[model samples]
Each structure stands twice: as C-alpha cells, then as structure tokens.
Target: MSDIDLSEAVWWKSRQSAVNGNCVEVARLPGQKLAVRDSKDRSGPVLIFSGSEWAAFVAGVKGGDFDL
Candidate 1:
C-alpha cells in the first residue's frame, strides 16, 4: 500500500508502559498499515509498517525473539 495521511491518527502507548515515558506509541493507519513513534518525541519521525510486517513483529515480541 502507498503512504497514507497520519495527521489524524490517534497514537496510543501500551497500558503496561512504565511511568518514565520511555516507550513507543502506535497508531492504526488506513489500509491496514501501522505507524510507530517514540512517545518521548511526538513530533519526531515515525516508522510505518504493513499489516503482515506488524503482525510478524508482534509475534516475535510474544515469542521473545528479541529478548536480550
């Protein structure tokens, strides 16, 4: 899918996020795309991803694929 306007997207951080505000916010874009941005920098850059890519990333997180 092509780029979609994100100016109206409502970003939300995980409920499990800590109080330090060191987290990312996620927004659901049109055409099943997802956008992620740093909570500490709301006006900063955003990383966009397709539905499948986001799903895989979520799966990885659930499976501890990125555990240190």
Candidate 2:
C-alpha cells in the first residue's frame, strides 16, 4: 500500500453510516485497487485491497457471510 500514491485520492463513506460519524471511508485507487480507512482517524492506517479481493468481500457482504 505504501507504493501507491494517495495524495489525490477521493474518499467517501457509505450513506448508511451513523450520524455520529462512526464509519469507514473508501477510496478507489489506480490499478483497480481500493483503500479503506476509519472515518474517525483519517490519518490512521489504511487497508488496501485488489479489485478481485474487494469484489469477493462485497459478494460475501451481500450474501450475509459476515452476519453474526
């Protein structure tokens, strides 16, 4: 992730986020990569994923694979 340039990355949070601002922000980076960071800590560590990895995660989410 350090090899990627995020200086101009545009980040946005989901509309379903809590009004208190407890949410994560996602940014689409170059080369089909995605970056995620905590909204409360914009300068904190970020999680980066490949396009395929993101797609699988989203599919899992929609499939309720993450449900407790």
Candidate 3:
C-alpha cells in the first residue's frame, strides 16, 4: 500500500456494524489498499491493508474465520 490521502477517502461502515453509533468504517483507497479508522475518532490512527490481504480478510469474515 502506498501513501494515501485519508483526508479525501470516503469511509463506509461495516455491514455487521450495529446502530450503537460507535462503529468504525472502511474505505478502499488507491492502489487497492484498505484503510480503516474509528468513526468516533476521525483524527485517530489509521490502519492500512494491501489489496490481496484485504480481500482474504473479507473472505475470512464471510467464512466466519474469526468466530469463536
């Protein structure tokens, strides 16, 4: 993932996110990178992910890979 302008990125919240109004959002940045940040903390730290890695993560989520 290369340098991205988080300031211009449009974040979309997770589908499983609840209505508690405290969920973070994910935005697809340039170079197929995934950017994440807390919705409640726009100025907070941002996490970046590569395209393939992000895709695999999404697939895992759909497959309940993190389910205990």
Per-candidate local distance difference test = 0.92, 0.94, 0.84
Per-candidate TM equals 0.92, 0.95, 0.79
lDDT of 3 by residue, 1-68 (tens): 34567778888997788887689789888778888888889888889999999889989989999999
Candidate 1: give the clashing pairs.
Answer: none
Among the numbered candidates, top lDDT falls to 2
TM-score between candidate 2 and the true structure: 0.95
* Candidate 3 lDDT score at position 51: 93
Which stretches of candidate 1 lie above 4 Å from their native place?
1-3
Identify the runs in model 3 with alpha carbons over 4 angstroms from their true place.
Answer: none
lDDT of 2 by residue, 16-66 (tens): 999998999999999999999999999999999999999999999999999
Q: What lDDT tens digits, residue by residue, belong to model 1 across residues 1-68?
A: 33578889999998999899999999998889899999999988899999999999999999999999
The clash count of every prediction, one per candidate, is 0, 0, 0
Best by TM-score: 2
User: Which ranking of candidates, highest TM-score first?
Assistant: 2, 1, 3
- lDDT value for candidate 1? 0.92
